[model samples]
Target: MNETKEMRLAAINNLIKFISERGRRFFYRERNRMTGEPQTAYLKLKNNRIYFVDAYTSKEVYAYSGYPHDGFSHGGTLWALVCDFSIFVRTGKSSNGKHGYGGLYSGDWGHGDEIQEEIINYAKEIGYLE
Candidate 1:
């Protein structure tokens, strides 16, 4: 792989590690209410930032800086850490309907499709995703 690809993979691996170490797995009741089935999500914390991931779909991954949270569950902190790392995977522009990119307004926004696929594939390879 080229330097860029290697760097991307490294970043992805780091994020996965982060989440695996400091993430939480929760049945998102709000989403589950609508979907009918349990919608599993992973949440992580870092300083004042919060990272969220749809564990099943691996499609919803983003970070929220300055997020207000009283506390977090003790379970699955590792997974939460990995999800928190998702922020680096896709930095988005400040738009009305775009994914929140660390609460930033301007950046490369990363490669959404490629990164998403890589995340999904990597998660499966490591048994994070079934």
Candidate 2:
């Protein structure tokens, strides 16, 4: 079924709201600098933004400097992801269907079938599917 762009965007945003409201956290794979042992932490989100102080430790593994990817956040790259999902629902095609994300995506930034899967699955889980 096809849906409007605005509708899809709203659904996506709602899913994010659901997560943030629950105070849910995610972890990134990181190795302890001092002990050389890998560990995970509950990455914190404050006021709709991720803060370093929110994490259990100051050190974060697999940190990104500028933008976030097509993952579960709403930032630089997520804007594109939202647009792509909207287009897919409306047009039934996402950037030629070659790549999961829309337009010219690169692995360096936001590009992966995993993100697409996350979006679809989460949307369905949250009753965002249309």
Candidate 3:
């Protein structure tokens, strides 16, 4: 199955709605600061933009920032991910053949249930319907 523009928009809208409805009041994560432990508030999305309420204590982190490659490479990385998933049933990796999410996926970070489910549901709803 392939995703249409409408399907992609729907998925994006669903993700936004899910986050808006059940994101968090004040989510926190452990951080390191000099000698004492610090608690960093989770990032927030407002009007489709990300913000940090507790900016001084928070750090920007990407789970796959250094996975198989540096994510910052300017080769349309996210578009490639979307294209491979939207068009093909597999990434040609025999070890994990036919799993919807393909080669470039990193394991989920332990943020909790809501975001994880939101990701999976959006994927399926957008035509990765495995």
Candidate 4:
């Protein structure tokens, strides 16, 4: 599906609402020391599966269902289900060099970081963070 930026944003907002309705709170904000941009990490767990999306980029969405060594604190298990541009791919190699898990891509959704930050901040204002 060729998703426009607005469509993708709507989908992401819907996902956040769905996850929130499931009684799972998952949102974290961090600042890059150099760029000073706020990066938000959206994570939710349901039925032993972890769902993750980078709020600032939204380039790669991850879903992992396996034994998480530390309650998924590491962001992934030995394998990862990654979706990029609606294409699902499974990978075992670590993208951040952290014990052979997760994957990384090199692009964004073209919505810019400000929009992403706004979404996250709005979520927080609505009490979506924990």
Candidate 5:
């Protein structure tokens, strides 16, 4: 879905704040059998939508919609990072194809350096990250 520069940046800023307040407490990663290193950021939900942001990716990532559900259910938690910042669940099952886009390759999309840049730019534009 398309979003205005303002809205995108606002969301980004909000995410940053949320992360700072929660600190690393909101993160979860799995160990890589081969490298023996932990995977990147873990997807988790707080409010109603799934917030997508990776500390590893220098590039800015977008906020993808999560499972379609309300905040009342799921203990007011409805976020899940299925794969990077691309595939996420906000309220219900947020399949890539289900949202109208076909980026359903079952892969992580928050590996790009632009993820950070995008987030910074949007945050600044919306006065959130500043």
Candidate 6:
């Protein structure tokens, strides 16, 4: 599979707003056994797509195609992480970003620290952290 995905800057910005306004109440996390600390996370869906944010890294957000039957079906959305915006999803019996990149991997392509930071701030601005 050699499919590339892209999300416009405006759409990306809108996603942040939507999540902040309606998703703040659903923020959740799991404790990393090694560190015994809880990481922050949030998920949002729109137009048959999911926007996942994992603050554990550079606080980046990735967009993935929605699940066939389950909205939260497993997979990675690292399409935007690389300069080429190349992304792919594999079939796996898992779910969420913690699923080892689900099926998406780009060999350390690149990540947008700016966009990543913006998402986190937007979530907080809408009181997702408060």
Worst 10 residues of 6 by lDDT: 83-92
Q: Across residues 1-130, which tens digit of lDDT does each residue of candidate 1 receive?
A: 2233234335455434433333231233324433566544554433434455454443433344333222322233323333334443333111221333331112232335555455455644433343
Question: Whole-model lDDT, candidate 2?
Answer: 0.38
Give me the displacement of residue 16 in model 5, in angstroms. Answer: 20
Model 5: per-residue lDDT, tens digit, 69-124? 32111111223322323232222222433443333232233334445445345434
Estimate, for each residue in 1-108, the C-alpha lDDT of model 4 and write its tens digit.
354433443444454543333322233334433345754444443343335555434323345443433223323321232222122212211123133332222123
RMSD of 1: 14.3
Model 6, span 1-130: residue lDDT tens: 1221233323333433443334231222345333556643444344544455442331334454333122322223333221111122222111223423422122232335554455555534432221
Whole-model lDDT, model 5: 0.36
lDDT of 5 at 79: 33
TM-scores for the candidates: 0.26, 0.28, 0.28, 0.24, 0.25, 0.23
Name the TM-score of candidate 5.
0.25
Candidate 2 vs candidate 5: the TM-score winner is 2
Give the alpha carbon lDDT tens digit for every residue of 1-130 in model 2: 3665544445544554443333221222234444555433323333433322112233422222334332323344434443443344344344322224433233433325666455445656544443
**Candidate 3, after superposition: displacement of residue 78 in Å?**
7.5
- Residue 107, candidate 5: Cα error in Å is 11
Better of 1 and 2 by TM-score: 2
**Candidate 2: Cα lDDT at 110:** 31
Q: How many residue pairs clash in each candidate?
A: 19, 0, 0, 1, 21, 0
How do the residues 8-116 of candidate 3 rate in per-residue lDDT, one tens digit apiece? 4344344334433443412222343422454433223345433223312344322122222232221233323333432332221122222334433334323367665
lDDT of 2 at 60: 27
CA displacement after TM-score superposition, residue 14 of candidate 6 (Å): 6.8
